[model samples]
Target: MDRVVLSFGDSLLRSSDVSLLDPPRWLNDNVIGFAFEFLAASLSPPLSERVAFLSPEVSQFTKCCRDEAAAFLEPLALPCKDLILLPVNDNSGPEAGGSHWSLLAYVRRPPGFLHYDSAPGTNAHHARLMARNLSALLEGDGGFREERAPAQHNGYDCGMYVVCVAEALCEQHLRGCDDLILQSITPQYVTRKRAEWKDVIGELSRKSAVAPQP
Candidate 1:
């Protein structure tokens, strides 16, 4: 499963000059950040503009002082838009502690923030902290709400679940679906998505080989 995600990331890096740095194998415990970059790059313009994929370092900084965190985010000049997908990690050391992923999605037509967590109880505090930080970053506009997304059935699939939610939300936004409900992305669905991504990676690799290089 990890290899599948990494291969997808490799394809994205080859296809575009994304902001995410090449992930080191030593950081094998997590590849969710790279996966999010791939998803963000896959989206079309404007919709893609609305999403901000934060590095694990930046996401981790939000857990500390609010003013400092806001300063870190403000310099990025992120688009204040309909949705911001954030991947969260509970621990600092790469191999030391457990990690979970979540999203801070903003719905503009209704004007509110929705914190969607795949593993609900485990990361509630992390999600709220992120919401508060985001609210502060957005200059005191608060109305952060929590919505229980489809829960993961096992321990290791949280990263994949994050990718699933991001994809579903992007589709919903593109189709103009109000409420932005996450689809029924079961574990079986994730397995299938992995297979699909494998094929995508192969196709992209072939295209990259033939395309003229700058």
Candidate 2:
């Protein structure tokens, strides 16, 4: 049986999930969702109230249909958010049904969805579909624009690119950057960022173990 290795907010990573951090292994939804949770928790006031980091399940679920989108997303109160970060997958499902992963973020500043796909155009359709769903909720009309992102040299690194680019964007926003039009992603940068995941998760786990529950 798989044991839980880390739990942060509503996200949980199993023992097997840690193996996905190994070289050439694709990062599954759990890790991405956990990263989103951690990032949201670390944001300061104002930004914290304006930004939202959605989980893979919530993002995927809204893709079903319009009625479902309204019923599901309305409760989340996404319209009031200035920025929303979502990890996109080629296939629409809560499970690891997609063969590829990408990052789709919506910024209310200029009012457009930004897609960062390491596999280039691999997950564009998925990004557009979900972006449309979010768009209708936010402003009733808009389209996704592909942002420059690091291209993965290998198939499995696409997932890491999503995490890395998402981190880069959030880092920029935290540092007082106004727009998501920044680009610093490179193969070497991904390497340095990806190398930190194991230690990051370990530290998070250690902290969770000692924290007082609500």
Candidate 2 on 32-145: residue-level lDDT in tens?
Answer: 788788878888887788888888888787654645776678877777877788888888554557788888988777778999888888888888888877777887445679
TM-scores of all predicted structures: 0.71, 0.88
Runs of candidate 1 with Cα error greater than 4 angstroms are 1-30, 92-97, 178-181, 201-214
**CA lDDT, every prediction?**
0.60, 0.77
Residue pairs with colliding backbones in model 2 are none
Q: How many Å off is the CA of 98 in candidate 1?
A: 2.8
Error of 2 at 146 (Å): 1.9
Clashing pairs in 1: none
